[model samples]
Target: MAGLAAAALLGTAFASTDGLARTGIFGSPGLTENDTSEWLNTGAPDFREVVESLRPSDLPLPAGRSWQPVIDQQVADGQREPARMQATGVHAAFAHYAVCVWDGEWLAARQAGDTARVGRAVEVIRGVPSWPIFVENDGGGTVDWLRSIAEAATHGDEGPIRQHIRANCTSSWIGVDQ
Candidate 1:
């Protein structure tokens, strides 16, 4: 049931982004089957799912593009409908891991005192869509945490945020490797 719901939501999402022809397994435009698997398995979100979660068919954030506004808007909007953010492994789970890996990179760069990489990581992390995380529960708090953690990456540490993401997101539905 969860997988079917995910498929339906993805079908609508794909159609909204492009057309019916794009609705397929790992058919989120630039994201290939191999790319999706590699990214999810490694916890590293590529250009597609990280920033382009809502519109996978579109290009990723270009150089110098800031994800602050998008993040702000998502946090404000709070959680979406269950059908819209189906709690499937491919979806909520994949998105969760992508965020974890992206933030993990930021925390690592901060620990290593790599200012440049830390800055770059922050930019990337800001784009992660929070809708999937909402699938784990409800309220704008989930979204707010994502934004706050992105900010924390800039000025403080995010080890605790990682624990929250992991404890909340353990991969359950479709599209997950486990």
Candidate 2:
């Protein structure tokens, strides 16, 4: 089932601004079918399940080393090379990792009733400067939507928040169906 979803998404060709159809997996240039298959089989986690079953113990330490630095460096490089910014797959890769981490933290905080942790996660989500880039790259405002959900989760019962996540969040990195 995952493979089918991945194939459906990754198999389709997208037209570039230059009016040419580029064929590649996950909208990334030079990605072969085997590469996509490997990612779908191993690299991509079932994020829907992850968020649904989140626990504080499962969360990454907020102060610990994170992928933020790598993401930041990618954005910095994009600044130097505008073409890199135009690469939608790169942005998706960054968003995939960042959102997974942020969502885990947010969900875990809510589960533990840790308002401070929740607030911190929300702040970080909101402060991500690459949000606009994600949107431009067809990420569909996922970061912004997650931020709003996190903000709302801070106010009251977390049941609704969890439901929202379950309903909306999917493993986009592997092209899973939402």
Candidate 3:
């Protein structure tokens, strides 16, 4: 899936920026960082059952540029639905990774102390997502906002944010470390 692929890319591609990558402030991936093998094996059965039970092709991506606001309002309202939280690995697990990677890129650009790169990266990463509004404590506010949008879009009971980013914002994957 595009979301999984994006997550994998974040895990490996932007290793420098990903705080989870030792270089990043987040530390590193724990024991479950092997690959998709585990997630696939476990999720396949349930996902198959869900597929068999639910109708296919029911999902539709949100209209152009509108989703960003809705997501923002939701966040501003402080609505973080735990039920909607991490339901799907693609949305939850992978989305988180992607944001982390993006954040790492943003911070590196900032830390490199390159004002121009930081500005460019901020612009690029910010535009990558529909709802660009995440609370990134890493100093890269725009990048953090974009990352938040990814997480919300993926985790929210809505369209495939992961797919959208993969298709439209591949360049956003370029972390500072990459």
Each prediction's TM-score against the native? 0.41, 0.41, 0.27
Over 43-161, each residue of candidate 3 has an lDDT whose tens digit, in order, gives: 12133332222222222221121223222322332222211111123233323334444444445655577667555545544445432112211223444445555454333312333
- Give the clash total for candidate 1: 3
Sequence-dependent TM-score of model 1? 0.41
lDDT of each: 0.41, 0.41, 0.33
By the lDDT metric, which is better: model 2 or model 3? 2
Looking at model 3, report the run of 10 residues with the lowest lDDT sum. Answer: 15-24
The candidates, ranked best first by lDDT, are 2, 1, 3
Off by over 4 Å in 1: 1-89, 129-140, 165-178
Model 2 TM-score, all chains together:
0.41
What is the C-alpha lDDT profile of model 1 across 38-149, one tens digit per residue? Answer: 1111112222233235432222333333344443323222223111222232344335445655555565566778888778777766655344434343323556666777
Cα RMSD for predicted model 1: 13.9
Which ten residues in a row are the worst by lDDT in model 1? 38-47
